[model samples]
Target: MRDPDAFYPGSRTREEWLAECAFDQACGGATITPGGAPLPGTEQAEQQPAEPAPAPAAPDPTTATIEDVAEFAPDPPQVVGEPDGIGVVGMPTNFVVDATEHTVTGDIFDIPVTVRFTPVSYVFDYGDGTRRETTSPGTSWQDLDVPQFTATDTSHSYGEPGEYEVGVTIRYAAEADAGGGWFPIAGLLELTAPTTVIRIVDVDTALVERTCAEDPSGPGC
Candidate 1:
C-alpha cells in the first residue's frame, strides 16, 4: 500500500493546514503570505502599543465653610441640678449646664469628611431678668468643696416667693478634618436648652425651749 504522507507531495501537514484555516476564518478569509505572516495593516495593528489604562479620576475637593460646619453642630445643652423643682426665698441655688462632644461625618463633593463640635461656653437665663455666662459648667457644692446654701459662681438667690423658669444656651466651636490636619471653623454656633421651672417658697423659724426628742410634735421641732 502507498504511504499516506506520499499521497500529497509539497503539501502542508494536518496541523499547519488547520492553523491556516483558523487564521483565514479569523481574518475573514484574508490572504496570508508565504511564511504565514499577517497582512501589512493587520501586522501594524498587532504591533502598535496599547494605550495606557486611563489613570483613575482624581478625588473631588473637600472644602468646607462655616455654614457647612454649622450643619453638624451639637444639639442643645443639658441642664443639671439637684432641687430641680424647688427653691427657697433668700437662699442660694446652684445650677450647672454642659454639652457632650459630637462627631459629624459625611461626604462633601464625593470626598469623605469629618467635623467635631466642642462646647466653649454656656449662657444661663434665670428667667427673672438675670442672666449669666460661664466658660465651664460649675460643679456641685461637694465637688467644689463649698458649703450648701452658700453663694457660688453659678448660684442664684430668690428675693421673693414665686415660680421661675430657667434655661441655658450652649456655644460650640467646630473643627473639620478631611484627610488633612484638623482646622478650626470660623464663627460660633449656639443651641438653647429646654426650659425648666422651679417653685420658690418662703420659710419661717421659731425657737422652742423643749428638745425635739422631749416633744415629738412640738411647734418648731
Candidate 2:
C-alpha cells in the first residue's frame, strides 16, 4: 500500500483508494444527524485483485555464439581459371603443366585426341616410351601400354620452373604392319608453358621423323 504522506508519485494501493472513494461522506457513506442513518449506497466496492504480471516471456530460444557468427562470415579466396591461363596439347611443353585449380586441388581433367588415316594404323606416343597403338579411330590413354596399346590417359609433372618446350611428334610410319600405308605426321607448334604444379596437354604431329624421308615422300605414302 502506498503512504499518502510519503510524497510518492503514482496512486495508492487499489484497496485503499477504493475505500477512500466508498466512505467519503459527501459521496454518500456518512451517517445522518440524530438517527445516525447511513447516507446511502457507498460501502467499499469489491476490489478485483491485480492480474498476475504476465509470466516474463520465456527468453527467446537461441544459441547465438561466436562460432555461429563465424560460420556465416563470407567466401574464401579463389582462382577461377588455369594458373596464368596455361594450355597444353597431348603432352607437356616445358615439363611443367597447368594444374587445374582442383587437380592441384584434387580434381582431374581429361582431354581427348582422335586419330584418322584412310585405312591404316595410327599410334599415339605419350612421349614417356609408352605408345598408343590403335587402328584409325582410337583412344590414347586406354590400355595403359602393353601388347594392346598405351591407355589414352597419361600423367606427368615437372620438377622445377623454367621455359620448357613440350610438344608431341606424330609420325606416319609406312605401316610396319601394312606393306605400304603412310601419311605425314605433325606437332611443330610452340607455346609458353604454364606455371602450375603439374599440367598436361595433347598434340598431334612430329617426333623422330627428322629426315625428309620421314616427312612422307609424298602426302599419303
Candidate 3:
C-alpha cells in the first residue's frame, strides 16, 4: 500500500490519526486541524476534563435587606371607624384596622424569595393635628363588649365639630426566606393605609317630660 502521509499535504502517521479521533471523542466532538492540532476552542476542551456544568453558578447569596423587600409589602386595609365614618364631637370615636400578617413571594436577584410582613405598630392621624401611636389596632365597641362612642385604645376625641380625614400608618417587621429558613431583616417598613373621612357633628341635650315617641313636638325633641 502507498504511504497515506504522501497523499496528505503534511506528514501524518496512522497512529496520529487514531490519536486525533480519540482526542475528538474525549473533547466531545472537537474537530482536528492540519498537523493534528485541535481547533482553537477545542484545544482546551480536549486537554481539560469535562468541567462539571460550572456548578450551577451558585445562588446570588447576598442577603436581602428590609428596603429590598419593601416594594412587595402591601398597605394595610384602611383604618376602619367604628361608626363607619361618622363620629360625635367630644365622644371617643373608636378605630380599628386589619393588621393581619401576610406573606409575599417573588424573585430577588433571580432567586426565589419569600417575604413575611407583620404589623408591629400603628400610628393614627386624627387629622386635627393630633396623632397617636399604639401597639394595638384596637377593636370596635361591639367587639370590645362596650357601647358605641366609648373610649378605646384607638379612639380619638375631636375638640370641635368638623369633617376630618383620618389616616393610619402601619409599621411592619419583615423576614425573608430564600430557600433557606426564614431570617429577619433589620428595620421596619411603614405602610400608609388609605385615609378615611369621618364626619364629626355637634349635638345638644335637653330634658323633656316625654319621649319623642310620646310627643313629637316636645321641648328640644
Model 2 regions lying over 4 Å from their true place: 1-55, 58-72, 80-83, 87-202, 209-221
The candidate that achieves the highest lDDT relative to the unseen native structure: 3
Error of 1 at 179 (Å): 1.8
TM-score of every model versus the real structure: 0.65, 0.17, 0.70
Per-residue lDDT of model 2, residues 145-169, tens digit only:
3322222232323333333332222
In model 2, which range of ten residues has the least summed lDDT? 100-109
Predictions in order: lDDT: 0.61, 0.25, 0.68
For model 2, what is the alpha-carbon lDDT of residue 182?
A: 14
**Which runs of model 1 end up more than 4 angstroms from their true locations?**
1-63, 211-214
Assess candidate 3 and give its TM-score to the true structure. Answer: 0.70
Task: Give me the overall lDDT of model 1.
Answer: 0.61
Error of 2 at 40 (Å): 55
Model 3: pairs clashing at backbone N, Cα or C within 3 Å:
none
Q: Which structure is stronger by TM-score: 2 or 3?
A: 3
Task: Give the Cα error of residue 187 in candidate 1, in Å.
Answer: 1.1
Cα lDDT tens digits, model 1, 140-195, are 77888777777777778889999888888876655556565444444456789987
Q: Sort all candidates by TM-score, best to worst.
A: 3, 1, 2
